[model samples]
Target chain A: MPRCRVRVSTWRRSVVGGAGGVEACRSGEVPYGGGRFNGQEGSEDSDSSVNRKSYPTTLRRHPSRMDQSESELKRFMSGLTLAECVGFVIIILTIVWLQYYRGGFAWSSDYKVMFNWHPLLMILSMIFLYANVMLVYRTFRHERKKKLKLVHAGLFLVIFVMAVIGLSAVFNVHNTAGTPNMYSLHSWLGICTMVLFACQWLCGLLSFLFPGVRHALRAWYLPVHTFFGMVVFILASCTVLMGLLEKAIFTLNDKTDTPYQFLPREAVVVNVMGILVALFAGLVIFLVGNPVFKRLSLPEDEMLLNEPIN
Target chain B: MPRCRVRVSTWRRSVVGGAGGVEACRSGEVPYGGGRFNGQEGSEDSDSSVNRKSYPTTLRRHPSRMDQSESELKRFMSGLTLAECVGFVIIILTIVWLQYYRGGFAWSSDYKVMFNWHPLLMILSMIFLYANVMLVYRTFRHERKKKLKLVHAGLFLVIFVMAVIGLSAVFNVHNTAGTPNMYSLHSWLGICTMVLFACQWLCGLLSFLFPGVRHALRAWYLPVHTFFGMVVFILASCTVLMGLLEKAIFTLNDKTDTPYQFLPREAVVVNVMGILVALFAGLVIFLVGNPVFKRLSLPEDEMLLNEPIN
Candidate 1:
């Protein structure tokens, strides 16, 4: 076994490879083209190599822990998108199950329908649109970088509107029911996540889109922006889980004649949704975090770097 | 701005730096000494520079985002440890509040004591020991590499034992009550996390500590090991949260006379605990993810590279 001389004084590009760096160094796995370690299989040349060349040097070197190729990663991404779609469907069905089956969703019926819209819209905004915004870079890797930014910004705007509607629905419920708002943990986290999301979106707009902010400031804020986006999304998911549990508790307590002891259909639905929601969030985070899965930076990125308005 | 001629062909040392890498590149922050960020006001040369010299060349080049001195990081760590301690105390008190006040623990009584032990021991093992196991490397960064390994392995062993006791206690409660086990989502997640923890611990022991395992295998397994450790710990915490919610729901539902429409004190306590637990997990993840906060790799790491038994 020949000692792999790792030159140490290089800059920080190495660490972003993260655990892969440690693994690569220790194993001395032939750089990129060798190991079958991280589930990398299938044809290497199915897709255009544009995305591959666009990758950061570290990613080009390490690829991923999975050593995923362009075609393989695309397949994985498609599977993930499918899983996400299914999760979305499950979330919607669960809301409908809780509302329609439980006699909560009638347009003619006043406040319950409004309350029903809270969960539906919140899931739509928080889980669905929020995930799409995060995935824009990945999904449209071939598109112009500027177009992707607009798409991201546009999606976020839609999310904000949906979130606003969701918030009003909940507030309307509290108002009509004469209950104090923000009393529950669910409400507290929900409101906090929403407020933080709004702040994050506004700052992102000012720093990235509205222009006039220094390039240095935007560069500094990018990681923070990425970090908080994931955090707020996680917080929202947890808040939703708590909300489901809270609702289940209240409903169970209200029911007088039910003889069900342990596992009911409603509880089963809730549990499955909880699992799906968690898995969905985890997968999205994984894709966002992995550089191999990132959209390729276009030539326009260089142009934007030079332009003052970008 | 002079073009920072980032040497392209250098190995992936930079990405491994992560947050520190980002900060260094963006701020071009003077290696480690010149900048006064992150409360590094006093230090010029208080500690030995052995650890500094031992850092990978990339870290030497990039150092940290905040330019936090060793003493400052140590101070930050101490503060975090204190916060962790406070959080641990809060968790214990909350359990006590729930058990003693809400009626579970009675030494004089027979079966209830067994039931009470479930929550107490689970929190002790699942949250406290699990978190400590995750933090051993970070907390004792300056310790001899061998000693840190022993500490990590030792802490995990204790966690495993505690978890076994915790599981049996829950099982005992179910057996005593003639209730079915593994029924609730809480139970399912709890059991799954425990099982995964056992597998992870065993694989870790074999791959890392056991003598016959090849270095290449250990290197490949390291990232997976680190990742699963965090994942299982998080799952355990989530399981505990779900367990608490499950218990609260059952207790609330059982009570016939209490006309509690608003958030009760018990609910508030549970919610606060949930928030604290989530925040603690988030903080630990942040600390672990930030390379600047990591304990510097020692010369012993190099020595181990040559040793066949390591």
Candidate 2:
């Protein structure tokens, strides 16, 4: 493989000097595009006079540690795979608890049964799909930024639809049954997570996906966007845990056969499912936050950095 | 203010090249010590020959942006202050919930009353105090490293003692009341948190507080220490939320007059307390994780980086 040269210009240095500079650089702000590895090096016009001046002074390729980086990349891939599996397990566990124990899902036919769909769909959309969306950039580190952005937006749209359906399931159950809505802590946090999530998604679309957003604004909003994505995901996880606890206690108390305090098999499964959701959330956050797993800046990214398209 | 000179040598570059390089540097590995600002410039012996060769190439001071950084620092301080106040509110709410609603705490007189101490003490030690301990490094960014280390360890010691007493309160209540322990999800998670907290504190004491560890090991362990620190704190928060849900349901179910589903005044207070705890934990984690609030490296840290005492 040919070596990829990295040129650190004066303008780039200045951009990296302030509070969010390093994070911006890491989040594809610094042009380290993947085009160089595809033999497209030096093809782009060096139109920026600033880049031309600092070209010779800071032109250097990192020492070839292909073997080491390869191993590390493999480790990262394995970790991602493990996170996906754990997420799948959580989804399955939820289904088992709902289908086998709580008498499977239905809509309008049985209000009690309809409530089961709430947990299942929530674990699928809010926890499972949300986590996978967070991992998409890391998973496709070499993909074009424009393509990845579209994929991200598309996936979020799907997640939003599923979340709406999940919310309706619980609300319908409560409304039809004449039970007070948003009375529990779980309901309160769940609504908060959903509201914040919708706002986050709308803001992301307007600021990032739309062409009218200014480069400066996008650069400034990137860190805030990243921070809230993690926050909303975590809040959703906590809400689900509380919901599980509420369901378990209500179910066990209403039925004398399986008390929650006795550690019934169903209770154990519910607890394990909650634990798995927390673990999955933690792993995704760690993987996303760790710099080692960050996408390597490509030569083409340098142009984007100067022009500010992404 | 004196301008501090930063010299980035080849050896330092290599150390920063690996997976954890940036984090290590941010955590005080690259030796951008604070002595220069104190008029101690060039006082240390530059015995390493590598430094001599790279001095001309990398020796440069960041463009003095004292005004920019100063305001940013103020913003960070304000954010921290808000987090602290939120944490204090969580503590106050927990006390009010326990003292006003649940009969006040006692050692062994009434098992039900004794259980009240468990939540109060755990909130004090595990949630409130733990968040403060995480903030100490950022709070005293310019303090001597040795001094900060002692303070960190001392704070952890206090936290540990309170956590132990908190654990005993619930155990005594459970044993005396003949109720099974560790049966619910909350108990399972609470025990997991306490055990992990103990292991983390002990490992921290041996590796950091003691003098025998190698520089390489300490350097490697620092990132792990920081990651697990955040993880354990989050797990603790999740556990506390579950425990609150359990208590609210059990208390409401046991007392027919105040059903949890009816959303009584006490139930609302309990739910509000849970939400406050989650918000406080989120704020603490955000303040601790944001790079903008990181402690500035000092000139004395350079020597420690080279010598490896920390």
Chain B TM, every candidate: 0.73, 0.78
lDDT string, candidate 2, B118-184, tens digits: 9998888889888888777667655545566677778888988888888888989888988888777
Candidate 1 lDDT over B131-194, as tens digits, reads 7667665565444555656667777888788778777777777777777676565665677778
**In model 2, what lDDT does residue A184 have?**
81
Q: Which prediction has the highest lDDT against the true structure?
A: 2
Candidates' TM-scores? Answer: 0.73, 0.81
lDDT of 2 by residue, A139-241 (tens): 6645445555667778888998998998899889989989878878788788888888999999888877776567657655665676778778888988888
TM-score of 1: 0.73
lDDT, residue A98, candidate 1: 58
How do the residues A1-310 of candidate 1 rate in per-residue lDDT, one tens digit apiece? 1111222222113223222322222122212211111111101221112233323345345545334333435554665666567666766776766575466654333776668777777877898678767776555544445565667778888898988887888788778878767766567668778888999888877767764566556655665677667778777877766666666656644677442246567766766676666667666655554333333333344344225434
In model 1, the runs with Cα more than 4 Å from the true position are: A1-79, A92-96, A107-114, A178-180, A252-260, A305-310, B1-79, B103-114, B178-180, B252-261, B302-310
Interface RMSD, all candidates in order, equals: 10.7, 10.1
lDDT of 1 at B245: 68
- For model 2, report DockQ: 0.26
